[model samples]
Target: MKTDGAEVLSKTVTQDEAAILDAWNVALLEGTSLQSGRIREAELQTQVKTVFGQLRDALASGGLDADAAGFASLRETLADISRSRAIQGFTPTDTANFVFSLKEPIFDALKRMPDGDATALAAGVWAAGKVLDRLGLQTMEVFLASREEVIGRQGQEIAELSTPVVRLWDGILALPLIGTLDSARTGVVMENLLQAIVDEEAEIAIIDITGVPTVDTLVAQHLLKTVAAARLMGADCIVSGIRPQIAQTMVHLGVELNVVSKATLADAFAVALKRTGRKVVRQQASTEGRR
Candidate 1:
């Protein structure tokens, strides 16, 4: 049905592949942002060759209907390119342009075909454009999906980074939470605190929520759950940063924090030190008379 596409692919892959690649790269870089500096010319040429080889084989077998089973390899190659570009911080438009920009080069190459007539060349260009447009859309879909995965993984990393359990002293750990305590973050908080307790053989944990903007029923519940989990791990928890507003709100909401509460992290730390039978003492200078 699309004999023109077959002819175009056969000729381009065999004769003018290098020229088309050069033209395609010019178009790609022109459309790309400054982020393209991360990609080198040799790497781009290698990828172009790989993608064109697959597309040539697919077009030979399936003509312009490259979405058929015969073109699975071509689709797979495009998807891999999209995913790699996404991880490399390429924009969606830039990634899709990697395929779309090839249209101009392909049409230009078709014009240089020795046996190409005007009508035949027009047919070939149209067929190639249609297939590339479809592939461009597929690339965009994969790029968006990969970018979303990257964002989700980054969010998880940030959550893990923020919820650090620090050893304040022997048998004492401090978990300073600095944001909203949702169910997800609560789970992380609990896991980190419990693991730290086991690793440090900690007897006391101080959860300082001075950075938490508000204290509501749900937040209170999450705190309680963390406290319960730590107790199970043989670590008593002290909820610090109990501001007057939060304490009053907890009372009105009838949220009972069964664990001990303190008004500040220092107060909680003092209590933790006392519970662990420790105190910070200053060294006093000896009062000796000097002649």
Candidate 2:
């Protein structure tokens, strides 16, 4: 079942490795990370050698099935490269090209093989191209999966960082929202607010959304969910930062918050302080004492 090209290509790489490496390095360095200095030349050369060695070994064993035992190391090597490239922000095309580019050097080597005839060379080149194509596709798949995982992790980290709970007083906490509120972020807000309530024994929480660009029915619902969750934690939530435009939108949408709301964080804080039986008192200036 082995293609004539596998035997030819394997022998070409095994006997003429130096030539193959030189040719491949020239093509790889022309417009790649090595020339741009993003990746160290030595590191790139090492990865090339590792993959080239594995391909030679796998072809010598007579199979290009990526799942086959002989190709295990090659698969893992490509996977590592794909994941690294993804994390480094390289596109799938850039990552897959690492494997596809090998075809040119390999085809060139096969052409120079003295024992190879036209028919055998044709078959070998065709088979080799197929193998490289499959490997390139594999790298792309891994790159996409890794990229998605990184994006998801970053999203969670951003959500956690955005929803900060600050203790304004012994029993008062403040959460300033700066962006759109969605279900996923609302969950994070609730978790943070509830944890802060438990940790600080807070009786009042002010959710300031002055930085939110817009407020729709869904955003209002997401906010309500957070408020309800905080109330369940034995802490009443006061929504703040209701811009005039946002208030009008909420009124038009008929969104019933059913909770205390204020036009500014300061107003909400003052209300919270009053509800907590505390009020800020300005000391009157003592003219007699100054004189």
Candidate 3:
């Protein structure tokens, strides 16, 4: 029976599965030894065996195309492996090398096939290379996509963490703006402040922008929107941390924040306390001094 290159390569890999796996692992380690601590060799060995087993089965099934329906399971497995490696801090080269490294072991197996001429061996090697190349490219694609998702989620978490609502007093909530207020961050800020107000049943919410570097018309509009949202929630809003430059810019830009304004958070808090009919007085010295 005259078998094609794909059949010859797949049969050899399945027959010498253990040796091929060992060689593949060695090649992979050689390529990524610098990242030795990122993953364990044993775990990598298991994953290697799984992927190789799937590849061998698919090739033996007479479908050399990596994207064929027969290779769907293999592609899914590679995507999972790529995503895992990406989250484990593996570089793209390291991730794709997981598929590429198998090429050498399969090629070596092809060369050692019994009764096979040099031409046949080369053909088998070429076929295996094309398949592995396709699989490696698939891995890289999945790696990039997984990395993007991780970055997006991390950015969202940072935005949420940056916007925290604090209860300054019983009837006062403070949202200290620290970074640039874009539309997205403004929405998060408004949601957090409004939720805090309802939860605390607060009557005043102070938005302090001491950390804000500049105030443009857009920023003024965001502040107004937040103030409007808080007022709709039955709480008055105070805007504080108005530097001379920011005040000047707001006036020049014809941007009006139709809410109580203060130059400092302390002043805003004091105003809130007075509006809520609360007072903070210093304790006098004991009368023993007068005695």
Candidate 4:
């Protein structure tokens, strides 16, 4: 049977080599699998050659100490592969599998260390795990960033609004705040909200925070800025669904949200209708002040 390059690389691993090669395969599958099969095959072939060359070089040196050096080189090769594979479209399971496979060789290397060197090796292994975790997180972030870019290029009419958990009754745009609000997202939210306000010609914007787990002073400030920008565009922004914990944090941090209107989404809708001169009751107040 004719095997593709990826299949060829997979075939190169023996029962003994499986554990070491597993992590590299996982990383590759995670980072570059979204691309063409030919691209993935080419990248995997290069990675396998590099790792195999390292192992061959280490084994060629003749000494009792050669095994330890070989293991160290293998560990470094795994780390390199893990880092290189940190691209968008990779899954967490792949990353986890790769990291788990390293445990055995890492422990083996630590065991072979000199008496006083054991602590250093253990620390090094721990650091390597952290590096892998960071790489995985960075890969996911790149994926999200790419998604945002695609959405941006699709144009306003075709771009679908992000559905929030709650929406206003009077067609107000809803902004669902979630995760850590770094400066990058802050800018994105600002641009998106403003453009949405203009595009939809919406009179009210309801920012619902039911999904946000926590808030800091910076995030609070970002929210405030968004509200201010909306008002400048002649659109009222209502911040609703603030969690009790986030409210407390805002108070503790001494952040004042004075200008931005605060209420539940329903209440904001009521207020927005009132601002737009849409009376709940069409009939004017009776002369006796009875509806």
Clashing residue pairs in candidate 4 (N, C-alpha, C atoms within 3 angstroms): 30-90
lDDT by residue (1-291, candidate 4, tens digit) is 332322222222222354455555554555534343433666665755575555434434322232255446655665555444444334445533434444454344334444435445545455435433443444344445555665576643232343322334454777877666667666777888888787777888888766667777777888888889989998888787777777888889888776555546566667777877776763556566554
After superposing candidate 1 on the true structure, give the runs of residues whose Cα lies further than 4 Å from its correct spot. Answer: 1-19, 29-35, 109-122, 285-291
Q: Show where candidate 2 strays beyond 4 Å.
A: 1-3, 67-69, 90-94, 285-291
lDDT for position 219 in model 4: 76
Number of the top-ranking candidate, with lDDT as the measure? 3
lDDT per residue as tens, model 2, 14-74: 9989888888887788746565556778888899999998888888898657678888888
Candidate 2: lDDT of 35?
Answer: 51
Q: Mind giving the per-residue lDDT tens digits that candidate 1 earns over 143-259?
A: 999999999999999999999999988998999998888999999988889988999999999999988888898999899889988888888999898879878888998989888
**Candidate 1 lowest-lDDT run of ten:** 282-291
Worst 10 residues of 2 by lDDT: 282-291
Ranking by lDDT: 3, 2, 1, 4
Error of 4 at 204 (Å): 1.3
Better of 1 and 3 by TM-score: 3
Each candidate structure's TM-score, on Cα atoms with residue i matched to residue i, is 0.84, 0.88, 0.89, 0.43
RMSD of each: 4.1, 3.3, 3.4, 13.5
Error of 4 at 161 (Å): 9.0
